[model samples]
Target: MSDEDIAPGSDVEQEVLDDEPKSILLGIIGQLRKGGDLSRVTLPTFVLEPRSMTERITDFMSHPELINNAPLNTDPVGRFADVVAYFLSGWHIKPKGVKKPYNPVLGEFFRCRWDFEDGSTAYYVCEQVSHHPPVSVYFYANPQNDIWISGHVRPASKFLGNSAATLMRGTHHVQFKRSWPGEEYTVTLPNVYARGILFGSMYLELGDSVVLKCPKNDLVADIDFQTKGFFTGVYNGVKGRIKRESSGEVIYNIAGKWTDSIQFTKASTSEKKTVFNAATAQIHTKVPPAEDAQEEFEARKLWERVTKGITTKNLDYATKEKTAIEDNQRVILKERAAKGVTWQPRFFTGPVDDDWSFGLKE
Candidate 1:
């Protein structure tokens, strides 16, 4: 039977599933998990470069002159072997299917800082592919299309030699693209949200397939929809409460336990302060429980991380090393801000030429 015909509970299925305990473990433990054995979960990410067929084929032994000069007495089987050898000689070889190199990364995770919109941004690590291989696309079937403008991956230094210290990978690095759709209304994601959900202009059902192409090569990775609907980013914060609303009613809220179809009474003056008075709406946010130190700590850390990443890229630096140092410095400032420290940077412009020459006095 073909691969798809195999049933999930069958031996073949079990074998396939059991073969990659590492990926499953990585998916569960995420980035912060400690211990020496768990350290392998972090892989050095790399982009694959594209190779043309002509460049790949030029060195092969199957060139016409080499094949045609074979002995006349060569048996049919021997001659067939010769033909096979000729063709196989120069086709640039690499594993053709899933056996291709997979550099799984524990991608940098951060809280979605977009307050004006409830959205989830994901950096899916996949083989870079230029053309649409065997894959599918779905969205709200509108003429204008739901896809926003596409952007390619930037040249970022990546960790080399297995350790997380990044190295400059390549000039022709992996090619990737990112796109978002335009929606009518602005949605808000509160700082305390433990999970994030974004509604697309298009809807997709469970078991449907979509393909995400890799930027560097022509590799295409197919992802099947396990759950119907929107993409989810479960927050690492365990202390705060979270809620989701559609129209007027609360669709989801995770506190002590997960609940749906519930309404939230305002838990705080701060919570009430942010509520909207509309026809009906959904709200999710962190209302820090009084005296809950652990929850407060986690929330503050998440806030600091998001703000630092957003702020550091804009700062000027004398050199790249200076820029790196400044970025770390900004993180310290972010932590201070989260703790309500009353400190701000002293702004200054370049000094004007002194009036020491006495030209201004004259």
Candidate 2:
């Protein structure tokens, strides 16, 4: 069976059919709206999903085909368009209305890999590098395709009456090994939102504009994520165009739904082709089991008990463990601060910089 066929469930998923958790979440929103920080608020463990944010970090790898053959394209401009399709593939991994994922503890990290059918492995690593601004640093590399992605996200979220909007402040660095003098493309992230939170109909929508640009190739893709409108609109709408960076002349027109497929049309011939198909796509995010993962770098190992408590509907156990973990992280931060020691990311050198060098060539 494929990895996507496996749902996020444990022996405990069956026990979490109660509706009492919604009231607790609603109360937090009222407090947060009054200038209370989301980071400082203590969320009820009953609302926790069975997975960790570190596990959700692997969602980008859900579309392996898009990234695998992108670097093989001879036309750097066309390749940039394919990369844009790839960047759009990470959304809508789960059905809407699910509870929020467990926030990663400070110093928490996750490591996993996907072995492609072509014998290439897509390796991924994510670290919760900051707590105050809630920054997550991630690295994805596929040795076979000679493609590497590195980025860090510092998300600023606000409750906009009925919906919560998160503006992602980050740039995804995509590098290829094929042609164009070893060029790199910077891919911007789309805005995230959860709609109908105030009236009880909760669904996700990715909105706003995102750009993908390759300076060396003079290629650019302008993508617009459209949200569902009040009277007449569809959910998960997306539209875009690919153009030359110098002349601003569109080479291709792109459009599709985020929950289904994306198509690109050539401006010259008006021939349209589907670039990505989500309904038929499958992804494999391989992480070691809790029993086998390394002590420090393992996501499953660190959150095993909490995961068990969540899955088994043991709220008391889950809440107790979650509190303990957060408390320990605070104590560790204090000790490190007292000694004038600063914690550094293991892979990312300058997590805050615009151009973070991988030193792959260095």
Candidate 3:
């Protein structure tokens, strides 16, 4: 191939430069498109309703391990509700006065407190009404002084639609040490949802940031996580909280109900580190830690080639000029080459241009 075809500034180079960015952007979109595969993945649609003790007992048989040492195992829903009732029973809230509906699938419970006196209540104050459920539940306090208790059960669909996913934004910082081993590393980040309740099965967005310093350089990085699952409503709901813009209400929010931290670190490996030149950049001789033999060898070879070429070119140019002065004029011509070589020819003569002054007052 010609030099035009193979060199850095060639047409091929320009074409590659133009297409590289588009190719990378398309590659990223391809990975995000994998979310479409969720169509084949089955997800349970929760139907929340009240159930009796007998029904809770039937459901317990299906998952016996869930209620091995617990009290009340009459029906599926009732058994689960009874378990919840036990936890709440410790509180002074009357069960009948509570009149709240619970959903097992979403792991949530709702109840109304007619009046809670801090004098008798150990957990909360008299003015504060408690509404904590199993996994994800919202409770609002009533300001009116004690007598009537009332609340409603509504689909979480309104609160948990597109808005829930958007409200789930976060950032974290992590440091990497060079002495750290392993190509794959895990940094236990503080749970992003530091203040939300675990609602039923919901989608969560997990993100991370890593800051690294090497020599004099530093950098930042990010990663994304997503998935779905049942919020046990127990300890492991990935709990957190955020303020609601629409209703101006603050509730215990759930960050991640379904997914765990599996594929959390999905970022390019190169961004995790920074590289800089080491001091004592190049060596001339090797004694011990002071100098490197390989660098010395490479430097010596480079200088030898460069000086040798300069000497050889000067000798060749002199020979050419000597032959050119044969018989035409017996003149010594001093000319400069296009490559910046200052050529001075020595002829069978004495002082060339000092004798003839071009009308200049020296």
Which is better, 1 or 3, measured by TM-score? 1
lDDT of each: 0.22, 0.73, 0.21
lDDT of 3: 0.21
* Candidate 1 lDDT (Cα, 0 to 1): 0.22
Question: Could you say which candidate leads in lDDT?
Answer: 2
Error of 1 at 215 (Å): 42
- The residue-by-residue lDDT of candidate 2 on 41-139, one tens digit each, is 677886466777777757777887887888778877768877888888878576335356777777677777788888888888777777787777788
lDDT at 316, model 3: 40
Stretches of candidate 3 exceeding 4 Å from the true structure: 1-163, 166-216, 227-362
List, in order, the clash count of every candidate structure: 16, 2, 25
Models 1 onward score TM values of 0.15, 0.87, 0.14
The true-versus-predicted C-alpha distance at residue 254 of model 1, in Å, is: 63
Best by TM-score: 2
lDDT per residue (tens digit) for residues 1-362 in model 1: 12343334421111122324435423544543222222123221111112211111122211223233223323332222232222222222222211111211111111111111224221111111111111111011111212111111111221221112111111111110121112111111111110111111111111222332222222222222232112342111111222222222221121210111112233333332211111222222312224334231232232333224333532122123324433664686579789998532111111123101101111
CA displacement after TM-score superposition, residue 232 of candidate 3 (Å):
25
